[model samples]
Structure formats: C-alpha cells, structure tokens
Target: MSRTIMLIPIGSGVGVTSVSLGMVRAMERHGVVVNFFKPIAQPKSGDTGPERSTTIIRNATNILPPEPFTMQYAENLISSNQTSDLLEEVVARFKTGTSEADVVVVEGLVPTIKHPFANELNYQIAKAIGAEMVFVTHPSNDSSQQLKERIEIAVSAFGGHKNTRIIGCIINKVGAPLDDQDRTRPDLTEMFEMPSSKTNTNLEVLQMFGKSPLRILGCIPWNPSLVAPRARDLAEHLDAIIINKGDMDTRRLQSVTFCARSIPNMVEHFKPGSMLVTSGDRSDVIVSACLASMNGVKIGCLLLTGNYRPEPQVMRLCERAMETTGLPIMMISTNTWQTSVRLQSFNMEIPTDDAERIELVQDYVAGHVDKHWIETLTQGSTLPRKLSPPAFRYHLTELARAVNRRIVLPEGDEPRTVKAASLCVQRGIATPILLGNPDKIQLVAEQQGVKLTEGVVIIDPVTVREKYVAPMVELRKGKGLTEVVAREQLQDNVVLGTMMLAQDEVDGLVSGAVHTTANTIRPPLQLIKTAPGANLVSSIFFMLLPDQVLVYGDCAINPDPNAEQLADIAIQSADSAAAFGIEPKVAMISYSTGSSGSGSDVEKVREATKIAQERRPDLIIDGPLQYDAAIMENVAKSKAPDSPVAGKATVFIFPDLNTGNTTYKAVQRSAELISIGPMLQGMRKPVNDLSRGALVDDIVYTIALTAIQASQQQ
Candidate 1:
C-alpha cells in the first residue's frame, strides 16, 4: 500500500525540491519507508545539473529508486500523438519506484524558463499516478496582495477538475525578519497566512474551507545562508583550484561582493558569508580584508583574478592571517568581469557527500513544516496500490535473494545466459549450475569479459552421460527408449538438465536461449511431467505495462484450448500471480463483454470462466469480457458493471493462442512495455523457457522467477 504526495511550484524558484526531499527525510526519521522520484527530468546539452536535488536526496536516503527518463523521449511522444503511451510509462515507472514505500514523494517540474507546454504536466502526472498534490508558492516574488492573487490563480488553474485534491499549500521563502525590528517589514500574510488574520489590516484576507480549500501546512522564513553554495562547490564548477583549503568545508558563499569599489567604500559592503572577488594585484585592498578577518568577522572565500598571486611579503602576511581566520583562497585565470559572467549561470546544489547539509535540511524542515498535518496524511490503513513494474522488479529480486535456490541453465555458453547467471550469483538471487564444458565456458566468459562470481557451478554435459543414461531410459522406456538412445538424448544439454531437475539434483531449470520453446520444454514435459492433479503445461507472460504488472496466460503455448484447459491455465496463472505477491483478480477475456457480442469464442470463454469458478470458489473470476472492460473502470461500468473482476482484473485469461499472442506482442511493441515470460507452468518441478530475442535483464528476471518458484514448490 502507498500514499503518493506530489509537490508542485506555482512557478519556478518556489522551493519544490526542498520541501519534497525534506518530507522524505522527516517521514523516514519516524521509521516510515519513504521513496522519492523525479519522473520527468529535462536534459540539456547532455548535462543533468538541474536534477541535483533528486541526486542529493537519493544519496542521503534509504530508497534505491530507478532512474528517470529524459524529457526528450516524452517530447517526441507528445509531438507524435502518443501521449497516452507516455502517461502509461510514467505511471508504470512511478508504481515500480514506490511500490514498497509507505509514502512516495513525487517531485515535479516547474519550467525553469518560460515555456508553452508547462501548463498541465504536473496535473496530468498527478492524475496518471493517482497522487494527491500540495502546492508550494514563493512569498518573496510578490507582496501579500500579489501573492494572494497568484495563489488563487494557480489554484484555480491547477485544481479545476473535481477529482484534483489539493491537500495543502506552503508559503516558502517568507521575507519577514526573525525577531529583529527596524527592517522593511511585510505583514504576516506575506510571511504566511494564518488561520485568521490578526496583523496588518491593509493586507489580503484568507478564508479556509472544509474540504476543497488549500490548507496552510508550512511557513518557512527567509534564510540566505541555508540556501547558499559552498566555496569548494563554486571552485569545482568554475574550474578554479583552491590554494588554501582552510575551513572551505564549512563556509557557505551566500552573496557575491565585487571589490570594484574603493577599499574605504567596500569595507561597509563586505558582509559575513559573502565571497569577495577582486584583481590579484590589489595588495592594499587585500590587506584591509585580512585586517577585517583578523578582527573576528567571517568572510566566506577570497578569489584573486587574472591568474596572479600576491607578492612574497603580501602572500606571507595573507597566509599568516588565513591560518588564524580559517579562510579559503582561490586563484582563477579569468578576469573579474569574465568570472562574474560565469557565476551568473552557476546553479548551486545541496552536496551529495555533505552529511552536515543533509542533517541541516532535515532538521530545518522538521522544525518549520507541519508534522501534525503530514502525520494525518500518512498515518492510516491505506489500501494497496496496484503493483507497478519497478515494485515488481524490486520485490522479485528480494524474493529471489531470500529464497537463494539453485537453478540450472543448459545453454551456459550462450552469452546472455552466462551474463544472467553471473548476475544472479553476484546478487545472491540463486546458485546456478551451467551444463557445458567448464573450460570452454570460462574461455567464452573471458573473451566476453564476463566475470563469473562464486556459487556458479559449470558441468560438462558429455561427462554426465554415464550418470543420467540409466535414469533417462527408466523414465522414458514406455516410448521404447534404450541405453543407446538415452545416452544420445542426454547429449543434448537441455535433456540432461531436465534429468537433473527430475532427480532433484537442482531446484529449477531455465533454458531456450538458442533453442525454440518446443526444443527447450519438450525434454521437461517428457521427463519431469505434470504436477499433481494438473492436466498439461501452459505458458504465462508477466506483462509489465505502465501502470501495473499484468498476468497474461497461455500466450505462448496451447494453440487452442477447450473449456477445461482454459480453466486450468487460468488457475495456474492466478496461482503464479499470487505467488509473486499479487492478489489475483482473474478475467476471462474474449471479443465480447458480458454476452453483448455472443459467438463461438465468447461462449467458450463464458464456459471456461464458469469452470474456473467451480474449481476455485474463492477466486475473484469474471468472464465474457473484452480487454477494455476487464481493465478499464468506465468500460466495465458500461458493459459488465456487476462482475467482480471486470474493471480491476490483475490476471487475464485469453480464449485462444492466436488472439493472446497477437495482443501481447502488439501491446509490447506499440507501448514500449516489458514482457518477462512464456514461463511454462504445471511441471512437477520448476522449468521455464525464454524467447530467442530476450534481453540480459529478461534472462536475469526469468532466472529470479525460477528461483522463487523453486522455493514456492519446496
């Protein structure tokens, strides 16, 4: 179960990243599993400096989420009229990234520069991911009156839809002074709107509503030093090396003070926590700055320009003062004007390696932000979110790691298979036994630069012929097998691997890398046979679509199934889904929806659904529904409103292989979805097959599934 909270800015520079990450830190401190994601990261010139906030939080947090795709692909999809597909992929990734978390912090984009397409991206993302949103507005941008108008306009624009839930709003970067008078004082509304107004009567008034209005959650006061960049950060970004690293680790460069003014005039302008930039030959000005530093004033860092250092005597004096003052000195080749221009575009980030900054951010947010409101939002018995691709992959890995079963592969010399085995062993997901010549396998691995980790065993299939020949003949003598024929069959690694699984030598077997599904599963069918009370083996694909990981059954096997075979396939597929932690909602899919388009195919599906229900009475099974009705709520409401599994079916059972195979492939290619299967079910022991064009990750997950299946069977 998960609750997603999306943070959006009224405009750019509205503190979206700070609040999003801060909440993750706060929620996590209370032992809550908090996950963070930035789904639509826009890349420019192949640089990702803009996404440093996400990098910082992920580095400092416990969540290891998936990386975001560049917005270039999303733009292409939008221009090509594939917005639905893009939205699906986004939701799918969101589901995967946050599936295991109690709360998910979805950080969204506010256009850094003015743009045309920035209007509803956040709203669309919120709706697609089923998340409630909280808006953050910068109070320093405008006065109390102007800020109120902007807030009203932004709320009207962003929360127009009836379903849009604006949980609260945060007034950040408030300009009010902290317990100090005699400054330019903006009213309390400018700082943050209270529940009822008690300050300046000239300011705008606010009225809170019961359910739809924006509630006040946080009022963050203006803090210049808290948002400042470190001296070393500027040095690295500017390609300038530090001459002295004294206290560079702790000092923050808040504002830039140009020493273009005279020494007498700039003395008044030289404030604490501000970088001082000037020409290198200005020894007179440097002496005054050192005197000020020696007088117990904090200066951030000193930058000398034009690639020059001070004279020997001046340098000695400056070094002596730096030792006592803890000041960092930097020299840059660029002149003062050029340096100022370069610093104009420099973006500051919370350093990924700075534990002190991380703690400060967390502590600051916890102190000012409303923990009471966040507790009310996150503390409850929330319903389970639909299983997403990221979540499924993470859970699959964890389950495989926990079970740690032994799964063997016959085609170990195959590159993808070898790589997958190496990954499984390295990740502690499984122990793999490769059926091939160990020397040749190692040779191929070295040629491919694939290092095989420990817990992987390589066996020569030819050497195992003597040991398996008697058992092969004993198991297959009914088909007129002899010792000669048995040895010949054992020459094939898949046949020998099947023999290993049949004798319980290995927990599971996965093959079909260089062979057809028939060549791979034929040995298993003949040797291992079906499980207890099972009629025949069928195949299922774990279709990892955008929003959810769906189970599609009999997509690779059974050319045409009768009612009984179809029911058996559904039952097995449901069991597989449940084994992988999905609560099964089975849908018998056909060309019809609840007898609306009756035909032979539809009738067959109806009968199969009935049979499946009788076999497993507790299963949430519905039938005679089309694909849309099975998965879409609106279509189900129109077509099969009373069916339990109509709109939210997690397992779909197709009527025949012709329709199922075509549909799964079409969805996979057209939507850029991932399919991890054609996994053969109903074997006495676990044996799975792979597609010829399977990726390395496909093989890895298939092996993980095999390991988990082995554990379940045991």
Candidate 2:
C-alpha cells in the first residue's frame, strides 16, 4: 500500500533528528526505498544552511546514490513565519517524492507554545499528504497519559474535521535503565497492542512512525554515533590507538576515528571487521594496503584522519578501494581520542531480538496502510496480497475460564438472540446457534438490521426438545435429577442453550441480555462443573484503549472470592493470556508488597499466590504486590525486590472485583483507554460475552481476537 508516513516530532528538547535518522536506518533494513523531507525548520542566525536534522537524515540514508532532486533543501521554499505555505510545500514535496520512492518520511519542525503553530502544521501536513501521524513522546512515568492529553488537545485544536488517523505513539529516548521496563509495560503499550512499541533503536522509532498501516512500532534507543564529537574521543570510545595527527586530518576524522600512526601498521591490523585509518602523510603505505585488501578482506571503514596533504599515490589507492570494495573512506576533522569520547557517551540500545518487531510492523503495514492510496499514487500498483484472514476467532471453551463472553442486548419480548447469533456466524467470528424458534429467528433477523447467514445453525428449542433432553439427563445423571426434572430446567429455555455447550454440542453459549449473570452461567456451572481441575470460573475485562490495553480480572464474576478462588482466578487469567498470543506473567495484585501491610485482603492475595504457584509450577507467578509495584519496574524493583513478576506482570489477578474493577476503570478514565472484555474463558468451547453497549467495531475486534484464541486452542 501507500508507503508515505508523516513523521510529526512533538515536544521541546526532544531528539527529533535522532528519531529521523533511526527511521531511515530501519527502513533500509527492510529494503524499502525512503525519501526524507523537513516541512519546517526554525532557522538560527549564523546557521546559513538547512537544519541539522536534515544533515543527520542525509548521513543515515547516504547508501542510496545521491540524486540532485533527492537532496533538495527546503530553506528558501518554506520559513517559520509562513505556517500555511509550509503545509502546502511539505505535502507537494512529499507527494512528488513518494512517486519516485517506495516511502517518504516527513519530519515536522520543533513544537511551539507561544505561537502554537506545530499542531496546525502537523495537521495540515498530515491532511495534505494523506499521511498518518506517528506522534513521538519522550518516555516518562506519565508519558502515556501526557501523550493522550497532548494528542487530544492537538486533534481538537488543529485536527479540525479531517480524519487524521494516528498510527501509534513512539516513546523516544526511553532512557537505558527503563528500556526493559518500558518494553514489558502492559499498561503503556496495551492501549496500542495491534501496533506494539519498538524498543531501543531510533531507526525503529522512525520506521514505526514513518510506515503506514499503523501498528505499535518498537521503542528506539539513543545512538552514540550520531552525537557530535571530536576525533580523539571517537578513537578512545572505539578502543582504537591513534597513529596520525594533523589539523585538516583531525576535522575529517571528527566523528568516528579509528586511529593509527602509520598506514602500513594500521593496514596490517585491519581485520575484516576492523576500522582502519591512514593519515595523508602516510599515503604511500595507505595506497599499498588499499591494493592488498582489495581481494577478499573487507575492511569495515577507512578514514583518512589527518590534516597533511594526501599524495597522488594515496588517491589512487582510495579509488581502487572504492571500486573494488565499494566502501567509502570517511574523512573526519578531529583526533582519535576526542572522537572516541563523543561516541562513548552516546550509546544506543539495539534490540537483538527483533523478530517480534518485524512481525508487528508488518502487521500494521498490512492492516492500516491504505491500499487504495498506494494504488493511486503508484500507477495502480498495490502491495502484494496478504495471506492471513482479516479476522480471527476463539473457542467458547477457552472463554469460560477467564470471563463471561456474554452477548447482551436490551431485554425484549420478541426473539433478538437469534439475530445476535446470526451476526456472530455471518461475521465468521463466533459460532451462533439459535436458542428460540427457527422460523421466528428468520423473521426477527429480517425485521432487525441483521441478516442470518448460512453459517448460523438454527436450533428450535421446541422441535429439538428430545435432542437436548438426553444430554441434559446425562449431565445430571450423577446429580440425582430425574429426566423430567432436567427437562423442566431446560424449559427455562436459556438453560438448554447452556446445556448445549456443557454437552459439547456447541463450543459455548451467550444469553445474558435477557438473563442475569447468575441465570446466564448457573446452568453451565451446574452442568459443566468447572473444567476438570478449575475451582471457579472467574472473569477478566480486556480493557482496550486507543493508548494501551489492560486485563482487569475477577471484575465481573467474583465480588470477593476467597483465597482458594482467587488462586484459581490467577491461573485462569494466565491461561487466558496464553490463549490470546500473550505469554502470561501473572501478578497477584494486593495493596501490600511482600508483608508491608497486614489485612484480610492482603492475606487472601498472599494465600492465592501460594496456591497459584502450587497449581501452576511452571508459570511465572508473584503476588501480594501493590498496583504500582506490580506494573512499574522502578516501583516493583524497590517494593518487591526479589519478586520476578514484579514490574513485568502481564496478567494481574486482583484481590477482589472492587479493587480490580476500580483500578482498571481509574486507569481507563484517567487515560481514556479502551476496555474490551470481561472476555469469558475456561469453557469447553469458544464462547464469548459482549457488553450490551458494545459498538460494532468493538464487536468486530473482540470476535477477531476470540477466533484467534479458539484457533490457538485447536
């Protein structure tokens, strides 16, 4: 699809240049052609050229041969005062460049408060270029909420009526110590799970922001190489010994100097991966080694690191190296030690395990990148066809363990259950079986907005009375209930549907709109009797927000479950996490960390932690932790120093529903994060519950997630 991404840099003192370069590097890794543009740059007096960020972008993407048009600077075309024209110029340039390149990344100027033009600029540029916004936020404890507020304000102030889609947020320069913490912060990235955050790479940060079809891109680390420094500092940081010295030479090697005194000596130590530098004073030796290393030995980098004039012989050698190895001899203007120090202080954390990053980025590009936009821009060309289904499904059996996947509707005299059921089947998300009259089901779907699809199997309760009677009798065979009594229970009607799931006739049942939670799950519990070892079937609310996603467990089912039940809830929640492509890191949430506080509430969680571990020995489980200690690494590290689950817990098992629901809702309301479930788990088949107030899109996503869960169980 369309590859153009509008990279809007926000906040003051944020490293926008570092982010831009990182994006280019990441795109290069994917073998995608990238063109860079700066829509606006606040010029400084005595800075007679383009912004420094532009220079960094050029250096990062210099692999592509320089084209006259590709290197165009917007100094004369746009100015800080001309905010309106700036938008037009940026869009025109971006559109023009997109035609030649696979993707174009546009970086906005620094944000402003007094004049407050950056928001307007961002909106105008995004709208004009049809570019999605990848807002960059400097990582902070309150970064998530701050970003949400800033975005809301910007959208309100400058977003206008235009549908400017925000792909995701990138927490830039997420500081080294907290990198791991940020990487696993469910509360932070949960809001944008579809587009997960990239960790510790600026290129990744930029690519995440620049690529269309928005997914949570990974977090980026600060790159040391890009930080300006002297030549000598570079050598020391790289652990290289300096060989040459000169004024002009020092300037050339100012960035990344690998110093050596003599060309011949430096050449001998030039391991294939080693960085080699020769002074112009030693051109003869430089020429000789350049000729020698031309065959199979690939030198990492060659630097002419001194001010002394280079002899013709060295020039010939450099030409030979260029022709044979295609490696540029970078010229720097500083001594080795100075360069080494500069590079040393600027450390960028590069994620070695990036398979997940690639997968997530691809998912975003596949799902959100506008195919139509791409086709129009690329002469009717589109991205290759995707192989996977657009939606996913889950089994009802899986939903029973964690939460009740009930499709609730307004109580009505007419049968609307069938229409809801039909909606489930037609969408290929849920398996729906009619609980009422088959004939009436058809009439109701026609009357309502829904149309029943062939996928739906209508089971007439009256017509199939005998069919379910035997199963009901068998389920209560040992419970001392007679066939007549079992049949009478089925007469409640919804109980028969629940019996279908218990009898393994269907995966699960959904009938809560007309019935209370007690009525909805009572028959299943009485009949199905909590899968094999399950103590109780608890519930977890998957709060899906635009900013993050969270799991609030035991919220809807257990009001104040005892220690034994809480333990079961913990295990079930962790299992549910696994079913949804998330590896469980269970957190037994309490008001106390360790034994800091004493109370019945804390005691229950502590006991539950013990029981949960005893039950699921292999799971990473820890508990009796405050909410902050459970989710925040710094807080967890301090509060529960020895607990493995502290600070990285993905599955939070609250002590009680009140605490669970209240905490989750507070986070949601404060952050405006979307909450998805009470996703039911622990059933024998794929059955889910929907809130009566659920939106169509909410239903669609939940269904997809449920289907995925079901497929995994299979």
Candidate 3:
C-alpha cells in the first residue's frame, strides 16, 4: 500500500503548490518513487495562463500526472450536492496515476475569495484518499502567538493532529521579522522563498507550535529567484509592444532598475538579469543599455515607458548590438513611475516555460524540509518502492554529487561527450577529465554551445600517451614484451583512459559514445581486468520502464553461458539491483513456465535457478519461468503459483546476450522508456561503456553510474 500526503494551505499565498512539488523532490532525493496529483485545476487569475502548478509539473518532470478536473466541473458538482461524486472522481484519478508510487503528494486547493469551500473540499478529499494532512502557512505581520493560534485552529479543523492522519506543517516564504521602527513596505520581489541569510522569523515560526502534536516538517526561507518573472511574462502583463523579442521567453528578470538617474549614475545598475526601465526618449540610457549588452552583460530586457519608441537613427545604430547580444526590448504605454507601481503588483505565478525556475524552487524548498521526518516516511514500509525514471535519475546525480569522483571521458572531443561533460561538472555530478586535443575539444564545445567549465579538465592525448606507454608495456609484458605495441595501443583514447584508471589516476572511465562496445570494453578487460570475485565480467542495463526500474543482465557481454555461469550471472545481477536500491527478485527467463514444459532451455534455466538459490539463499531466486509469468501477477497465479519471485522480479538474468539485448531494446522503444546502462559489472575499477548511439543524457548518467561504482568499490 502506498502512503499519501496532502498539502493544504491554512491561509492565502502560502505557496502550497511549490511546497507540494518540493515534498516530491525531497522524497525522490531519498530514492523513493514519488508521484504528484492536483485534484482540480486552479482557477487562472487574469491572463496568467494555465493552472500554475499543473503546468509547471507537466513541463518540468518526467512524471505524467493526470490532468486535473476543470474548476467549472468541480463547482457544478458541488452546487448540485454531488460532493461524494466529486470525491470519488478525485480518488479515481489519484489512484490511477499513483498506484505504483511509494508516496503520492496531493496538492490541495488554496482558499480564495470566490472559492470559500476550498478547505472543505480539501478535507473531504483527504478523508477519501486517506491522506495525511500537511498544513502549509507563512509568517505574516501577526505575532508568533497569533500564528500559533491560527495553526492550532487549522489543525483542530483537520481532527486536531491526534492521529497519524495529520502529518505536520510546512512554513513557506519565511524571512526575517520586521522591526517596529522600520516603516518600509516589504519589496514585491520578496514574495516567494529566497536564500535569505536572516531566518529569525523561521525560528520563531517553527518554535511557535511549542509541543503541539503537529510537527514542523519544513521552514522554507524566502527565495526571490523562485518568483522571478520571465521577460515575456512581464511583456504580456504590461501589454507592451515587442521591440526585439530576443530570448524574452527564457530570460528572467531578477531585479528591476528604473532609470531615474542620468547615464553616468544609472550605468552602475546595468547587470546580468536586471531589467532596465527607461523612457524611450532617453537616448543616453538606451545607448548605455546597448553598450552593456555588447560588453556581455545579459541585461534581462530594455522596457521603454511612455508609449515611446527609439528614434530611427538610434535604432539603426543599436540594432546590430541588440541583435548580436539577443537582448530583449519592449515598449510600455505607462510612464516610469506608473510602470514601477504596476511592477509592485506583478503576478508571482510561474509560467510553464520557466522550467529552470520551477526546478530551482522545488530543490530550494526541498532542502529546508526536516530530513529525519522524510526518512521516517520510508522506513519500515513493507511495500517495495517502484523507482520511477525521474527518481532514478535524480538519485544518480545526487549520489554522484556526494561522491564527486573524477571520471575520464575518452571521446572528449565528441560533441555529445563534450556537452555531457559540461553538464556533469555544472551539476556537480562528477569532475570529468576529457582526453583529447585541447583545441579540438574547445571547438566541439563551442559548436555545441557548451561551456567546458573550469571543473572539466581537458588533457592533450599526445602529452599523456608516452607516460602510459611504459606502464601498459609492463602490464602486458607477460603476454608479449614490446614497448612499440604498448605505445601504439596507448594512442587509442580508450586504452589511455583505461591505463589511467588502472594506475588510480582517475576514479572511473566512461567511453563508447563514438566507439563500438568491443573497442570500449576490450581495453578495460585487458588492463583494468575483473574484480577479485570468483567469476567473469558481465553487464547490466537499468531499464527505466514507465512504472519502475528493472535490471537486465549480460546484455552487452557474455554471448552464452552454461548453467553454472548463468547462476553466477544471476547472483551478480541480483546483487547489482540491490546495490542500486532495487529490491532483488531474480527471475530466470525461459520459453516455458515451471514443470509444465520439457526442453533443453527450460531444464538449463531450472538447473541454473537451483544453483543460484543454493549459492545465495537470501535472494529470492526462481527459474524456468516465461517472461509473462515472471512479471504479470495473473500469469504467475495461473502458471507458477508457489514461486516466490514469480510475479515481482526486479532482476532478469537472460540465458544469452541475444535474448537480453533484444528484449531490452524492444521494451525500451515500444514503451518509450529510458535504459540508463550497459553499465559493466564485476570490474575491478569503474570503467563503464556507452552505446554508440547514446544521447548526451545517456553519457552523463553512465558517468554518474561509473562514479558511484568507483565510490562503492570495496
């Protein structure tokens, strides 16, 4: 059974949507398969576009949450006294989307002026879904005592927190308490949570509960970046005419600078992500903006007030700079002062296209949630957690960031490898040392619009090959002592990278974006070799199916094996699944299920299953089962009713490479799923190979897997 947590706002503007998303992210970081559900679409305010949270989730995550019922449909149901039907509808949608999830975070409706029954509907939905309530609120001008009372009232309305149904509270958009002497109004930009240094208000708010049963799970500090509006959002809000729609949809306005001063004084305010609001008549300020754009300052936009357009002469002169810099420019009818006033009341809703801001908000808020409380949600749960694709990807990056291993990418100058290296460094997943010519790598990075950040180390192969020649010659001397052959082999980047791994110069190696599997793995097998285990090297692909991640073994290695070797492969695959947080239920796949069929393949599979079970009694190993009985519950009941691993197998040990590789590719393409590997197992050091047709993300995740394997190596 899956657990459900519903986030309901106790007051207005508590940022319930963001808090819900954050909860999902926090759980995913802990490797839980979490799902998100918004019961009903929120009524769009003005021209702010689609329901904010729903749109963001749809665009930003691999999670395909069911589209929420329209507000009109919900209102009509309630007016006709069909509240029960409404609750049933919500429950059906929630169950349909979250059946395989470990935890489902349901976003409750925020009570608005026109939607007074929001709280009641939220309560009913919570009861219907058996959801634990997490009341969301923010600190206001009211004293801590008053805030405590409000929380108490809200908790009492939700059955007074006596039972586990009332999980806790989340205080959002928390910042410093206001001073009595300070009469300045809070800045409009201070709306959503920011990375504020001052958190006195958060402390006070967290302590206000004062031994109340309701736990304070999170105290998200104010972060202005979460609410930063895109340039196009501002333009649409102000009904501004487009001057130059350069990067408007992507550029975010972090701060606004009104050109109240002359060119010399106002020039200091020009900076990246700052919107310059100046009248069009001010040629001095406009030209200054252009100059800043030319100087590589990514000015958010140039918003001209008073319905004015720049003179044709000024436009002609600055057109080249604006066009080259892709600087957004807009014209608003309101004067400077009026525009500032309108900006103060700007909508804080997130646009669907602002994926960066949405992810930022989720991660930022997730950081502040109590880790202990989050851990408790996962502990002692009997149900197996189905690791979703997003959860797996997030876990890989998070784990890679913690280990921070150095991985060598042999095909560094390859475009995908270059981009993946940059992304890995930027995301703190790994320090990628790219092995290629520096000039060629730079050219590739530039062509791909990838900034090979400082963390990405590039080494010229010519300079490094000679150093590894002696070592390679020494390692292969027993086979044939020849420095000439060693030097020739070291010319291959994969061989050079494998030598580095063998020498402990790098923690891991990721290659094969441009090379064949044999070209990639042959050097590793020759130099790095197999681990100290009693068996041969094998490979597994983390097939990220729609519902969960399954491990398919020996897909990229071992053409065929006897019963004993197949048993060893099954053990290795099961252990691998367990290492990656997947519960191991090894299934030995064959053309027939159980004792019903007699054939050489079935007998081999049955004997292999017996050998595996005898070797590792702890793992749930079953065999001679067809693919359908291995995974389908009904088929398992009809075919192999007494088998422990019949219906729910996380690891499939194929009899041969042909079967494993074909099945993985077929499922991956037919289901449109992502397979993270071909991740080599049983290697002494972490040296993973990629597909020749691998995308940038595929290479990045493979790098992460290699880093994790390196860190976890005994």
lDDT for each candidate structure:
0.77, 0.54, 0.83
Question: What tens-digit string does per-residue lDDT give for candidate 1 at 222-302?
Answer: 554456777887888778867777778877775677788788888865555668888888887777777777765567788
Better of 2 and 3 by lDDT: 3
lDDT of 3 by residue, 264-330 (tens): 8877778767888889898988888998788666788999999989999999989888889889999
Choose the strongest candidate by TM-score.
3
lDDT of 2 by residue, 1-714 (tens): 555566666665455554555564444333344567765565432345545455544432332322221112333333445545645655565565556565666676566553255666567767777776766655433334444455555445545325456665455554322334343221111112322234332233333344323344545553322232333333433454333322212221212224455554454454433345555465665665466456434344456554554666556546756565544344556564554444434322211122222222323333223333333333443432211111111222223224323222212123445444555554445554556666666655543335677766666677666677787777778888787887788777667766666565555455454466677667767776655556667788765432123456877778899998888888888887666545578888887889889988888888989998998899999978888898889997789889888887777888887888788778768965456666666654444555555544445445545455545545
How do all the candidates rank in terms of lDDT, highest first? 3, 1, 2
Candidate 2 TM-score to native: 0.46
- Model 2 segments more than 4 A misplaced: 1-427, 614-617, 641-643, 665-672, 685-689, 695-714
Candidate 1's C-alpha runs over 4 A off are 1-383
Number of the top lDDT candidate: 3
Judged by lDDT against the true structure, how good is candidate 2? 0.54
- Alpha-carbon lDDT of model 3: 0.83
Provide backbone clash counts, one per model.
Answer: 3, 100, 4
For model 2 the local lDDT of residue 433 reads: 51
> Residue 521 of candidate 3: its Cα lDDT?
89
Model 1 TM-score, all chains together: 0.54
Ranking by TM-score: 3, 1, 2
